[model samples]
Target: MAEAEFARPIVTVDIVLLTLHEGRLCVALLERSAQPFLGVPALIGGYLHTDEDADAEAAVRRILKAKAGLEGIFFEQLGTFASARRDPRDWSVSIAYFALVPQGALKGAANPLELRPVEAAGELPFDHQEIVTAALARLRGKGAYSTIPARLLPEVFTMSELQAIYETVMGERLDQSAFRRKVNDLDLLEVVEGEKRQTERARRPTTLYRLKTPVAVFDRRI
Candidate 1:
């Protein structure tokens, strides 16, 4: 008797949907309904269809929509996870795609499309914890030297709010003076002509600002 070899490999597509919710970095997670991890939280994913092309983008869109009931979102290929023992059921290789969406957009949706903040370290069923860690590192690295961080911000926000978002994502407190200087030098923000009213605070409202232009830089080394 000899060991048997399979004719084909099992391929899967996993999605890591990332977003900023109320100044906290969050990711969309789903509860798995199948075996080998049934009832545990997993990224929205599925087996690749034979009829469909091996195009990662198309596969991710299909999986995201089917699992998360989400569509028309932006995604970037993170990397492939092909460990021989990553999946227990069979020999499976998963291609990971990371999606970034605005917070509050998918709130109260179907199938537990809830957003969980990435700030606190928690338990993730699969290799999702690794995937999330890598994705956040990429985002932080890209934010320092690029304008991708702006995407996580709103259409109009105060300078403090902008800094807060960045600080939260970077997991570090930034020097207020230095932060303002860097942002102003970048000239990426356009001062909106109005101030946001703040009733809770005893001080006056701060001026609001918007992104001056769309960013073309895509280098992930922020």
Candidate 2:
């Protein structure tokens, strides 16, 4: 007897949610629209198109734009999953990706569903809860040594704002003197002239600083 085609090709996309909320790192969560865990909270994702190119990054980007109507986000491939039973559907393998998008950009008009940001401890639906946990953990690790947090900031912001992002991701408060020391030592930022905005407080207005180079300019290891 000839061998039958026992398994089918499985393609899917998963997006990593990143945002700043209440001076903390927040992740986007959604209610599942279909079965396998219908109505449960999870990250936004969908199936891939077989007819399209095999570029995993591009595929995820398209899904994000189509589903969330967001673009120009800093996305990176976390890894791949091929667990025989990861998906209840006939042995499907998925390429998992994560993204870092500024909070303001999410307000774009193209967005369909209200992508809400979640803070504090909570449970997410499906394997998605695990995916978000893992992705955030990875980003936190990178945060300690890399400038990934800058991706969550505006083009120009105060040093205090930058420090707040790091503290939010790290889930703790940082020392003012030391934090300033670290950023200055890194030499990763460039001060922009003029256009300074004052804060609600009566203290001296903080100067706005912008990234000196693209993320690619920095070593992956930090």
Please tell me which predicted candidate would have the highest TM-score against the true structure: 2
lDDT of 2 by residue, 1-222 (tens): 345755565777777767775555667655667887787766767787767847777787777776666778788787776666677765766777778877766654343343444444376544666677778788878777778888898788888888888787777788988888877877888989976778985377768899887562334322
| Model 1: number of backbone collisions | 2
Local distance difference test values of all predictions, in order: 0.73, 0.71
Write down the lDDT that model 1 would get: 0.73
Give the winner by lDDT.
1
- Runs of candidate 2 exceeding 4 Å displacement: 1-4, 109-121, 216-222
For candidate 1, write residues 1-222 as lDDT tens digits: 334753456788887787787667887778888887898877778888879846878888777776666677667788888775778866668888777766656653457765688655367766778877887888777667766566666567778777877777678898989888877776677877756646344288777888776553533322
For model 2, the run of ten residues with the poorest summed lDDT: 109-118
- Candidate 1 wrongly placed segments (more than 4 Å): 1-6, 21-23, 50-54, 119-121, 193-205, 213-222
Question: Poorest 10 consecutive residues of model 1 by lDDT?
Answer: 213-222
